[model samples]
Target: MHSPGAIQPAELWRLFMRAMAVVDYARPLELLHVPAADIPAGHAWIRVLACGVCFSDVKIARGQMPFSSSLRLPHIPGHEICGEVLEAPGGFWFQKGDRVLVYNYWGCGRCPMCRIGQENLCLNLQGWVGFTNPGGFQEGLAVPPERLLPLPPGISPEQAAPIGCAIATAYRAVVTRAAVRPGELVGVIGVGGIGLHAVQIARAAGARVIAVDIDPRKLELARVFGAVAVLPEEAEETARRWGDGIGLDAVIETVGHVHTVDLAIRMIRRGGRLIGVGYRLGDMASIHTPRWVLEEITLMGSRYALRHEVEQAIRLVAEGLVRPVIDEVLPLESANEALERLERGQAIGRLVLQVGSFSGV
Candidate 1:
């Protein structure tokens, strides 16, 4: 949120797009210039068009991606990617030149979760695009053929990437954690990429959405996306003023800050539900259990979306229920710059690396 708008904030969008990859010296993404690889049987690679930037990418660039990894130096940092298939190993469901959206999480197919068709939370996922494996901030990508989903006609690649990550994550948190219902009221905290989508999808599910964000600009964006009204840390006063209120029917906490979490807890009605969606680091925030027990509050943790859930997100985009907000996209040449923007809270929606673009069937 711009402070009063009378003051123009510094760098509404960052100018740098540089990154020191895990495998290479800090370099401009364009200068590094990696080549696309051929697809071998049972493997698939994509020619990346647009890849949405993510908070986790910021962590990985700073050595934050989890697991004991032998990350190739010069690793590309992007996960929310959308494009057409360049090559597909046999037995895969795709073909060359089909518009597609990628599922970011990678899991082994034999695991129970995968066996039941949930691979996004894979137990033995080798590596996700932009984390351990080569990602989409390049001209193309090589992925497990099964992880790619064919997109409905007319869905732009730029729009697809955000849904793959931001939209899917929010959708999963609401459906799996919040268990939202029609006509219920939803109090959503942190109205950025994930937060904004939580509002739209909750509204799509028939819930009246009330958005909370520190920035007035972001809250304005939330209102544009159909939020009933934006709460600028002023909902506490509003709630008290509206005497008929019983807090919120559901609260989705996308902010990891301790104070924000406490506020989210206080905003929900008794018998409410809260989902923690942010990928937080360090010590966990202290949550008092007595209030949760006495009020019968429900809390759940949602990771990435599974296959079916991801499909649902794609459909939401196709139907125009939600739209991805892209602040800036660098050419992988600006990885460090992108991450820095994330660190400084200067980016909106998901920042992306425009690795390369192509046109074909």
Candidate 2:
């Protein structure tokens, strides 16, 4: 590890590090030695230990997301990151060898949303870690100290990685956005990575969670996560039946497809809420305007998550209230294979990449 005060920013840039980069659109990531960017003032140099592979990473690699067109070439894309602090500026809360989970997005800090601690909903957006900024597919990262959340003692780097995205996003949707209460009938649409976590979070929040998915494997995993699993064809009916013939009190939509969004809307009872957590770039869902108006149904979109919510998720894992379902953990070199598996819908839960070996502190 380099001493914090010994190396200057320009000198840091002269060093090169290994990374997996997207050099062109719709192409495989190339393993290359790229110049290390300077760790800015007030930031820490994090040695990445693990990174969870999100479907958005796949979408970006395949040029499916709208923002893909604007990304600088050779972009490294793994946002759900876990790492250890290798170096830090003085007076910061974090120090060398401290385990941390990264919050992957940033905002203009002065925006109204940011002022209120909702940086994920910032008006003048800065960048996303894996989207607009260089991300954790590399061995090391330069991250702002405020974005680093300490990993609790019980969580390993691999176990804590997905908390940065999947778990944190689900916690925000179920607990914060939807405000799922005890005894409320909550339906989680699409039992994928984030959806499964939503099921666990809602259940932990004392709600009866009904999980809907087309894949039997995922439905079974949802059952293991404390939800009543059902097929998509049976979701609306199941929710209605469980809600005393009305519908669910809230529906958390993790599959942002048009049909799933439509199904989520239909599964909510009068005065209920539909929280959209998953999304594609241009996909649109049709809503019956009159029906929604008369029934008082609410449609809301949940982006990533708040910073404090990430810490809450870490606590949830620490207390064993929720477990992030990881289908497999592969080496960093297998990122392309991980992406291919996720794109094909073969993964039952979140897939993670072991960036570097780090025993828990």
Candidate 3:
């Protein structure tokens, strides 16, 4: 790989972590060299410094998640990204040598959702950065200039990458979807990467956060994130006690399993809301309709964040209101190991991959 200063003519190397067929586990990501001329117009070339590995990456690698068939073989998988600008088209705002974080969602600009600042829910959705498009697994990527957000000072690229997805998703769940208010009791299920952030964001929103997770360590970590209570086991019993034996005001379900969804349903108050940010493909949860209607339960599915939400999440991290809980930082060569650790339910927070050199930029 060439150094950031050591410039070649116009080509960049990338890891093509593709799976030709369904497998039990995630395979190693392969490397490839993409020519500059091959990149489409209106996109800026960026030198990736760090990219965070998400749990959804594991599901996609195992062929469990439903992806578009249009995506060809040898696909590169990584959404959470922080990089430095290398090249941009004329008249673009971003110049070379700018430190920036790539926004994961790339929606069609003309869509009503995009025009209304809800690009994450664009009616004509194109795809996400790492899922449908070539992602930050590579040393370099070509992204739209509008999708790049300026990285604030004092935050490293590794810390900023996961903000693009993990923290941003949590922000949407707690702040936007759930609309957590002051003095409300919020339950954060699954104290993983997204859940941990949800814990802090809920706390920041003045809600009493009760964290529920099977992992003891994550439950403890949740306390550090300002969770008022922790429930390692008997989530229903503990949540009832925390909510005065009734239920919580809102529940952020990050695990995305049938059980977690069901638990969130049982843990919410009569007029409570359940915001789902996790992806459990092909899994179905049974909800009692009579109770759901009688209780005025609100079930909302929050995808990634919009452009404005990305900026808001970054500001929270910048101001020290919310911290990115990173478990491990590894080189790009250790991508497979990182994915395996995340898949085994061992990661407490986010796992980041240091792809390229973070030099002067």
**TM-score for each predicted model, relative to the true structure:** 0.85, 0.94, 0.90
Worst 10 residues of 3 by lDDT: 14-23
What residue pairs clash in candidate 2, if any at all?
none
Candidate 3, 1-361: lDDT as tens digits: 3344555434323333212122233455554554433346888878888999998787666666576445565667788989988778889788888889898777887988879877777888666777876677777787888889998789998899889999999999999999999999999999899999999999999999889888889988998878855564577777788788788999999988898898899889898999988766588887899888988999999998887898999999999999999998998877778878997988989999998876553
Model 2: ten consecutive residues of lowest lDDT: 7-16
lDDT of 2 by residue, 128-207 (tens): 89888889898889988888998867798889999999999999999999999999999999888898899999999999
Per-residue lDDT of model 1, residues 1-361, tens digit only: 1133432343211122232355533433333444334444576756677878777776676665554155666676677888778567777679888878787777878988678776766778766777777676666556777788878887777778788889999999887668899987787888877888888899889987778887777788888877755565687554434324677778788887777778777777778887888746663665688977998988777887887788999998888887777787666667668777877877777776665455565
Best by lDDT: 2
Model 2 steric clash total = 0
Please give the ranking of all candidate structures by TM-score, highest first, separated by commas.
Answer: 2, 3, 1
Supply every candidate's count of residue pairs whose N, Cα or C atoms clash at under 3 angstroms. 18, 0, 1
* lDDT of prediction 1: 0.72
Badly placed stretches (over 4 Å) of model 2 are 1-14, 359-361
